[model samples]
Target chain A: MIQIEQISKSYNAHAALKQASFKVDRGELFGLIGPDGAGKTTLIRILMTLLLPDSGKAHIGQWDVVKDYRKIRQHVGYMPGNFSLYRDLTVEENLRFFASVFGTNIKTHYHLIKPIYEQIEPFKNRRAEKLSGGMKQKLALSCSLIHRPELLLLDEPTTGVDAVSRQEFWQMLGTMKEHGITVLVSTPYMEEADLCDRVALIQNGEILEVASPKNIVDHFSSHLYRIKGKERLGLINALRSLSLFTKVYPFGEYIHCTSDEAVEPVVISQQLGQLGMDEIVIEAALPGIEDRFIELMA
Target chain B: MDSIIIDQLTKKFGSFTAVDKVSLRIQKGEIFGLLGANGAGKTTLIKILTGLSGASSGKATVAGFDIHRHVEKVKMNIGYMSQKFSLYEDLTVRENIQLFGGIYGVSSDYIKTKTTLVLDQLGLQDSAKKLVKSLPLGWRQKLAFSVAIFHEPKIVFLDEPTSGVDPITRRQFWEMIYAAASQGITVLVTTHYMDEASYCDRIAIMNAGKMEALGSPGELKAAYQVDHIEDVFIHIVR
Candidate 1:
């Protein structure tokens, strides 16, 4: 249960957030998806009361962000994008310190973060700085949840961690949600846009679109075809020159081309063959979240 | 030509070996990506090549200069943007450029032209006088990148330059990298994002202080028979 209304923030001339508004339902794994400088962090800061907004208001349940910062801080687990843990402190020490700050002991909420803590428990004596990026992430998440807050706010928590660790971190977040803790995570990866229950695509501090990942891609009004040929560069050049294609993005070994009008696979293969292409495979395909984001951005 | 060459490179910090026998080659005019989870020795390897840290027992040459010797020449020939936005937060955008330029012994006249060029490229011409703390994260990241390579070093080392920027900004940042490569500037970048590794000309994946795989993204993906770099990485590291 979070509500943000018309939040605006700016740093000198660069506008970070321009009256952005959104809401997160209780127990929802909500995602604030955007590129950098999209005001996702600013919103998180405003909600956490770490930074005050120039205008607008935000609330966590009944308390306001600006007026009840202390109360909100106690109730919201926050993992900042930056490495905020004391570099010199050991993993266990940092967890204990954060737990004490929230007037709770690590053991009191140890089970809440056991899945993550177990990964770093062996290195409990290791300093925060000495741990790997993935270890630091787990330690940070563990500390943040030591108080068993009602909400969790993670700002690109997996940005610099490995893919497997990123997956593990999301799994931990899901466990938190099982306990009825509302989780709000922000990420820059377009493919990660679907991990949450719902995502709000943001850009330049404005909400572009908010919908389920599948819904977003399904709503795309263009027909897409996955095509590939022996002459990669030549095929790419020829396909771009064709006016029928709306978008031609190279996806691994194949080219995902979106067309203004639905065309037969034979037509695509014939055109590529005419471009002196051989072994060309053309088939109708589904668009991904990143594809949908590109289309939205376009 | 290979802009960088590493032969059985290894770096140890006391009892812990940070980069263990890592060897790789990066070609000129190519955008080479380094992939690793955190603490996988990506940054340590970069530091060793940059001469920021001495390799424990390895031979490496960057831009044709040996890492063990010619440290100053290595620093002069390479422009580095660290993972953190290491710009002076208290200084104005232009002042940061001026300070860095002065440290590098750039002429006042060249600094003036370069500052304007970089600011305009980052769409921050109007905010040149604004303090670094007053800039948005995305703008600041672009500016940091511009500042790192302002002197036009032969090869640029970017350590997770797009950690937090949104997808659109990341795309735009890649365009800038392409532009740099077009000018024959070799790029050595480290990132955790697998998708980003796909966009690179060649990518080397590392795990547990050793290189897991290295090749053009296409080749690696094809060899692993995967649709994305993420799956390829999973196949190798697992």
Candidate 2:
């Protein structure tokens, strides 16, 4: 469980966090969704008691983030945005070192890290720096779990990782939740928003919306459509020029267009046809997390 | 026009073969994407093509110059931008642009005109006198991209150009790439995001130093019987 109240932090002239407040329930997987300089890292660091917030109070369980910094440090596990593992040490040595820091041994927390550690066991003797990005992530997860902390804080864990590895990393987090560990993850990828129990969409040092991903999408007020045409850029330009469309964005293979009023698919198809576009396909679609984020941003 | 052609290109480091006899071709004005898991040899292949690393065997040609025989020519004809953006944080934005233009051996007059054009295009003219470290990450990334292609190189290699940016910024970044491709400049990009792969004209998926799959996003999806490129990637890499 985690709680924060009116937390605000500023570095010189720039305010990193402004009146930001959110809570995470026990065993809940909470996500902090934001861009690079949107204060996700600053908030995470404040909650971890590594940096002191200029104002407000935060508590992990009953311990205050400031007053109980020492206790909180032992009770929480943190994986920094940048890999902080000892590069010169072997995988097993790194794990052992983290375990020893918490006044425990690897065998003591073997059951806690078994699922993730087993994947990297064969390369236990390899130097941490030599491991692949995915492998290093797994090893970091393993080390973080070696202490059996009740709370886990992951800062953009899947930012530079591949899709399959990103999926696997999230899967590992899901398994951790099953083990009754509470997780707070920050990521720039909007697709990962759906995986969290709840997400706080932060931007420019302010929390815009905090809700479940489904709830966020449900709150999207516009009728959305997906339009595919032979000329991708031309389609975007055409759709943007239309008054019927409130927002037009190129999403993957199709251009996602939003309307203020409900519009028929046939009408859109006819309009594109009149515009000399070929192979036009228009269909009603449900909004996704990215769509909702863009709307919230606007 | 074939901007890049390769055949049986192999790059080995000591006992490990990083790139194992890979072959592919990229057309001019094409938005070619290289998709692969980390350590899948995508970086190795790009280095070999860009003349940063020597291939252990086989041959390749980039920008109408042999990679091995005419390394300088190949280097001169291509621009590279990685995730780090490779900008000098200590220098002002104008100074950074000038330094890159000088390195590419562009004339002083051309650098002056091009600098003004690039700053205007990116809307960073107001920040030209400020240090690169003072600007936001998004602005820095766009500036890095501008500097990379300032010389109007035949091919531009983008290595994860939109890694940490939000979805909105990523969309805007792709638009710039599209503009470059429209100008008949070949764009070869490597990305971990499958959603971005769909934006490319063609994509090649690499796995364990081998080309596991290569085709347009539509063709690859049809071949894999999947609706999304992520699923197609999983199907091939798994």
Best by DockQ: 2
Question: Which stretches of candidate 2 lie above 4 Å from their native place?
Answer: none
Per-candidate local distance difference test: 0.84, 0.90
Model 2 / residue A154 / CA error / Å:
1.5
Q: State the lDDT of candidate 1 residue by residue for B1-238, as single tens digits.
A: 9999999999888898889898888888888999987777888888888888888897998998988889889988888886575699999999999988887778999999998888877888889889998887767777887887788888999987776675556655765776787787899988887876766778999887999898988789789998788988777667
Across A1-298, the per-residue lDDT of candidate 1 in tens digits comes to: 9998888899887788999888899999988888776788988988999899999988999999999998998799999999989999999899999988988898887778888899899999998999877788889888888899999999989776788878777878878767899999998877887788888889888887888888888878789988866554466668887776887766544667898789898887777668677788889999888777777877
Residue-wise C-alpha lDDT for candidate 2, range B114-155, written one tens digit per residue:
999999999988999999999988888888888889999999
Give the CAPRI class of candidate 1: acceptable
User: Per-residue lDDT tens digits of candidate 2, residues A166-230?
Assistant: 99999999988778999999998788898999999998889989999999999999999999876
Query: What does candidate 2 score on TM?
Result: 0.95
DockQ metric for all predictions: 0.34, 0.66
- Best candidate (score: lDDT): 2
Task: Find the 10 residues in a row with the least total lDDT in model 2 chain A.
Answer: A228-237
